[model samples]
Target chain A: MKSSIEVHNLTTAYGGAPVLWDIDFQLPTGQIIGIIGPNGSGKTTLLKTIMGLLDPASGFVKVFDQPLDKVREKVAYVPQRESVDWDFPASVYDVVMMGRYRKYNLFKRTKDPDREIVLQSIEKVGLSEFKDRQISRLSGGQQQRVFVARALAQGADLYLMDEPFVGVDAATENSILNLLSEMKNEGKTVVIIHHDLQTVSDYFDYLLLLNTRLIARGTPAEVLTKENLTNAYGGQLTLLSKVVNLIKQNEFPIREKDSDV
Target chain B: MNDFWIILTASLVAINSALLGSFLVLRKMSMIGDAISHAVLPGIVVAYYFSEDKASIFLLLGATLTGVLTSLIIDFLSKKAKIQGDASIGITYTLLFAVGMIMISGWMQGNVDIDLDCVLYGDIALVNMDKVIVDGNLYVGPRAFYIEFLGFAIIGFCLWIGFKGFKLLSFNEDYARSLGIATGRWHYFLMGLVSLTTVVSFEVVGAVLVVGFLIIPAATAQLMTDKLKPMLLYACGFGILAVIIGYFTAVYFDVSITGSMVSVSTLIFLAITVLKRRKRQTKALLKSSTDLRG
Candidate 1:
């Protein structure tokens, strides 16, 4: 089986300082991979680099054995939910239709088939009822689902989502995860930038633990060991464990300084 | 009867500005439109100085070029100097406008006459004097009308054809770029269109008043709805309405028609905002009442 995405020595930066340093990874086709990291761990940067949103200072990113730009049609991206202005005057249907725009000629109107695909995508995301609703009126979960529906409308074989589960309710998150699993079953590679450690084992088949660089890449069981967790999280394992215990007890956990010096 | 023609011409100008303003508001580049309006004055003055005539096409072309150059300068300064977008626009427009005023006072003092007061507060009544005769048929209207009409058509066509791209680029440029859309190209293209419109309309509305024409109607529509197509249509409707009503008001009062039109637009904006606020309050009250009953 061939890898769907290959990033070798990828380093990206905004101006002079680098955001992602010496990142390397290979994602196989037809698998759901979770990219877990701390805040500013370059998870979004890695995804953006692979998607050709930002040019890597020195490295190569190949999608399906070709340059990312050449294989753009085969890849879909769902950016961070906060990247767009919800107040923008567009309906859910209008946003989904945008995914099909690249397939059409610049001067040509969207064809019937494109419209059908957009409708189907909306239906797939359980947003058919809200197709005509203005995007600003939808809740957070619904907005996230609308963007997912847009990616589905693209009909790409590979999807790169940045924090799709952020601020979403449990039901919406489960539905989105299920939809991603379904995509994997259909031989699509889905790479998601996920934050939760507890759901890592169940949600993804592969994991890429990153802390501004490649920490580990393997199955969840293989990479989520105590040693790898400590390396990626950096002395925060006790805090993570306490939070997990608090969640299990239905109480919020607050961290305090252990001034035992 | 002459007042009717004045109203008609103002209405056309309003319609053009409103349509173009819709996109400008959406992109949040309304200030750039404002800047181009002022910056084009130097171009017009220079062209008039060289041609020794006010009716030369060179003036229009030069104004359009300078409008585009003003946008580029703003973009460059914003990027290079790390200045805020609005600040860059302000600096560019003020400098260019000052230069234009100096040039008008120095070079074209006695040779060609272009009134600075008329440039600041347009002369719609005088539009009847600059008539173009086509095949011996007298078309009694300002030459500015034809230029603005052609500009509006081009802008309308561009907006109609590139509606989806513009929407995508405006709303989510990063996503658009990742989707293989050249969002930067579209941004520059939209700015170019805006500059073109500003140059053509400058002759009719002046510089400062064009800001009202570019931002007011769109803002009024924005207060009313959250749908792009309807917002644009409503803006055009509001603009035409303001122009008609303001022209008559100016005629009756013997005052500045441009000022009246802008004041009417501002009033419409305020009215919509108040009405929307009241409607929201009512909905909130009703929702709380239902919650209490439950």
Candidate 2:
């Protein structure tokens, strides 16, 4: 079990307050790992620190047994859909082509093979018809797909995503999960920051419950214990019950599907 | 010859502004250009008071330093002190601008050519009078021509080489950084470009209206096109067109050249906005008529 990410004693702060303090964990390679936490629980901060987008104040983050710069090309990140200005004047193809660009090819234009990869990435996400359409005209789900396509085009071994399913349609979410599973089958690792605890078992093979600190890390069944939920959620009744219900459904296995309520 | 120099100088300002201003506008730092332009005045006044020479190149050095400081102060206040971004910009520029105003008022009663009115609105028509005399007396073109052209050439070369880097930085900074590109370096490099451009353009449009040259044409081009490349080219074309119209308008009406140029740029922006509004209404009307027939 090769380690994909090893964060040790990492403390990242914005200015005065530390968002993530003394976070220590190692995620295994070739697994869909979800970092679940409430809002402002430093979920995004952890991903950013691992991607070397933020400087950790007190500790270090290692990727692939080396520093981030040494293995940056092997990592692809999909920032939150809300983080970017959707109104920017770029077509789907233009935006997807940004991932095909590496530091070595900064001065050179895209070659024919890279062009084919960009188009194939676009098609993989079912956006081939809207390749030339301006990104601002895209629906939220389509825009989310565009970002996934960008991350996919990087052809990286490790993918870090911040809330990729937020505000996406059912079909888009399903397609992205399928796409991510395909990547996992190819022996790539994906670490994602996700909300909605109900689907943790369905979506991720491994789980990390974060609350400015590492609360738990293991398989979904091991980490989703009632004791761990209460510890992480801090007596939040709604979230505790949601996980309780998830555990109940996992045991009973009677419902055909999760229909309304 | 005088008319050619004035229009050419203004066009150069237009081109320089568009080269860097497009990125600024997209980055949502358009007002920083306005703020830095206004804040460089104290540097100009202080440089003149110390050197006692208005033509000294140190005036540019002093003002450029002040322009860069204005942005740094804004960044410090907004990022470190928990201050709101807009309030930080407003606070930084006003303080520096007032300092410049105080310096100019005291120097105005003395035997100095640096006055408040001239600082606010520069006189571009006197460009021909400031000729660069070569080694012992061969008269070259206007000195402003050299400064403005140097600014344009340097900006063009940097943007051409770093186009992909800048494009990624402007569109998605986080993704760029994750790719191991130093986003902080490109950000400050652009700020330095904007600072240098503001200093060179400060003489032509003055401390107050330099933002007009940097912002208005880029904004107008943004309205005319959605793509960045076309936006840049359209900005250049719109700026040159504005210079021609504004130069002729100034000559016929006997007004300020810089004033007329900015006013013309603003007018073009307004005209396009109105045309776009009407086009939207027409599209809606056509859709409604077809729906009614069905």
Candidate 3:
């Protein structure tokens, strides 16, 4: 089968400095791939390059064996949860309806079938009761679910999500993981830029360890070994072990933490 | 009787500004309204220097061009020059406004048609003099009213037609672009409308006061609701209401009508803020009470 995503010699930069250095990868369809890296490790940068939001300084990204612009309808991207202003004055229904905008002409009203699909997407994420509620009134997990429902409503075959599990409750995380698995069962591909190391093995079948460059890519059992993680994490592995111990003790809550160190 | 025409013209200008201002406020570009209004001063002065008339269509075109240039300059400075957003707006508008002020004093010293005071605080009372007449005696309406009315129609129609695009562009630009929506073109289109609205309303509300109608009404309405369509409707309603009330208050107190209108808008915003705060407090109190009982 043809690869769902292919990146060749992809090097990207901000200003003059390079963020992604000669990154190459091929992701096959029907698998959940986790992209794990340290903070500022070009995980989001890779997703942005593939989404065509940011141009690569060299090389190119192909989605479903075609340029992103040509097969845009086949791909959906969920950016970081904190990227948008939650105070924006839009209802849940209005935002989800935006997912169906590509299907209609600029001036045309959304048809009944599109409405049905939007409704189904909202219901799938268990946010049907909050359909008319303002999006800002929702909790962080609900907001993340809203974004997922929007991606679902896009009806895309390939999904690239940026840190969807951040700031979400355990229940929301479970539901999202189940939804991602269902997508894979439907023969679609999902690539998630993930941060949590503890659930890496349980959540993803295929893993790509990265730190500004490709460290390793294979099954989680193979790539999540100590040496590969040490290469990806560098000196931060000490902090990583502390976080791992906290998770092991089931005391680490996923909330925003700031440290002066 | 004359107050009717003044109120009608002011209300029309308010509606136009409110319509475009809804998007500006949502996009967090409300300061662009202030920038364009001031920056158009030089454009109007230049156009009047050539045409020697306050009601020239050339004046409208010139000011609109300057408005677009203001936004472009702001974008260029912030994106290319690496200046911050508010500073870029400030640099562009202040420089243009200063040039306009110098032109009024140095170049066109004795021009009978232009008045700097009137430009700053518009004289709605004088709008009756600039009547649009067809054929020689057929009266249409005050020229300012017709210009602002046309602006209102164009803005309303554009918003109606491009409703979804504007919403998507304002809400999430990356998602819009990924869906192949030509996000840049839609962005420029919205900026173009804002410039046009600023120019069209300038003659009635002056440069500075127009900012009030642009930001205050939409901001006030934002506090009232969370949906885009209703927010727009409420903004228009609040704008027209302010114009009517401010006109009467000006007539009663013999004050500056523009000042009265701006003051009334500010008062409405403050009132809404207080009321919304109280409502939120009440809800929190009731929730805590229920929790205690449980």
Candidate 4:
């Protein structure tokens, strides 16, 4: 399998405090990959580093065997929903149209084919009716779908999402999951920073268990071992029940809507 | 003729600042407009000394550099030196403005044209006397008029070409960077525009009053709309209206023209804010009465 991302000894810091320490991973392509860890575990930091939004303090990261700048057009990023001001005066179509902008066509008018792609991306995320609606009027699930649609409009092969599932309804989650599966089927790679341990196995084929360092990286079943959990999760017993279910190895744990972190 | 020139010059100054101020307000950097206006005072003093002309292109360039410098210092102090954003801004502008003040009183003491009082309140009444000479005898127009007209053309062209990049930068800078856009280029380009607008409008509205023109009309429009395009349009319109109304009011009352204009803009802003709140309350009351009926 060709490598989608190769992080060789990446150490990133915010201000002076180093968050990620010597994270090394060469994730395979055409897989739904999840980066799982506790809060403040540098999951978002690593994702930002991969997106080239944050400069790593030490070591380097290569996407598709080249630097991020060399393959920037091939990458799409969906920031956390709370990262932007929801009250910003932009409609759903206006926000998604940002994806169609390129260096050559930035100053030119929005063409017909670009509009078609934006509409198709909106439809894929099930937001065709609310295309002209202002973003502030949308519900939490619909807001998340808007970001997904924007990323889809990029038509990039690699999608990097930061906690895309937080505060969204189950229906939105399933639809987004189906969309991710379809993307994977079309030979694209997706990397997500996820919080829900219950849906870990079902949502991702590749898992990167992280806690300031790369704890383990492989198939979800291979990476979710007891030893790996203890190393990354150190005294975080709140997730023990889900860990116990994984330890039992009987079946995949069903998602409890109320218990999501 | 003086009345027409004063009103035209003031309207031009108002619209120029309002157009750029729309972006500044949307970025939640309205205070930056205030900061940049004051911070460019020293640049104006320095450029005036070298060029010996207020409307010299060299002075515009020098002041724009200072404005961009102010932005860089604020970003550096906040991001690198770990100072709070408001503190850094306050520190930078006051320091630069004081330097400009010292240059005026210390060296340019006999120079009454660039006096501190004139720098603050400006002399719109005298703009008609300061004419642009074509061949040393033929007068063209007021210096402020030409300055603001050229500023308008430059600002309008940049806004047209950079509509996409600037919009993305205002909305989500990180997402814009992810699309291979150079966000730093747009950020500095905007800083440059703010600088240019403030420097040119200085002769018309003065340093402090330029911020009034920059923030008031844009803020007033913002209180009434939830879209960028209409907010900008309304801001430009409100600015012209304030210039016209304030021009007449100043003549009628024998008051300061620039002061009255900004004052009128504030009144408009306050009136709209109160009206919007009243409408919201009425809607809520109607909804409750309907709920009771149901």
Ten residues in sequence with the least summed lDDT for candidate 3 chain A: A252-261
| Residue A50 accuracy (lDDT) in model 2 | 90
Candidate 2 Cα errors over 4 Å, as ranges: A239-261, B42-62, B98-113, B132-140, B292-294
Write the residue-wise lDDT of candidate 4 on B1-294 in tens digits.
788888999998998899899899889999999999999988988888888677789989998899999999999998789898899999999999998899988977676357777777788888998888898788777988999899999998998888887888999888988888888889999999999999888888888899999999999988877777888889999999999999899889999999999999998899999999999999999999999999
Q: What lDDT score belongs to each candidate, Candidate 1 first?
A: 0.83, 0.85, 0.87, 0.89
Off by over 4 Å in 4: A238-261, B108-113, B133-140
- Kept native contacts, as fractions per model, are 0.66, 0.68, 0.71, 0.68
Candidate 1 has an fnat equal to 0.66
Per-residue alpha-carbon lDDT of candidate 1 for residues B1-294, written as tens digits (9 for 90 to 100): 566666766776787788778878887888888888888888877787788656566776777788888888898888778787788999999999999898878866886577687777777778767776787886666666676677778888898998887778878888888788887788777776766766666667777798898899988988778888898899989998888888878878988878898998888889889999999999999999999999
Q: Give the TM-score of candidate 1.
A: 0.91
- Candidate 1 C-alpha error for residue B97, in Å: 3.3
lDDT tens readout by residue for model 4, A73-177: 899999989778877778999999998987667789899999999999999999999999989999999999999999999999999998999999998999899
Q: Which stretches of candidate 3 lie over 4 Å from their true place?
A: A240-261, B49-57, B102-113, B134-139
Q: How far is candidate 3 from the true structure (C-alpha RMSD, Å)?
A: 4.0
Worst-scoring 10-residue span by lDDT in model 4 chain B? B109-118
Report the Cα lDDT for candidate 3.
0.87
Better of 1 and 3 by TM-score: 3
The most accurate candidate by DockQ is 3
DockQ per candidate: 0.55, 0.60, 0.63, 0.60
Candidate that scores best on lDDT: 4
Model 4 DockQ class? medium
lDDT of 3 by residue, B226-274 (tens): 9888999999999999999998998899998888998999999999999
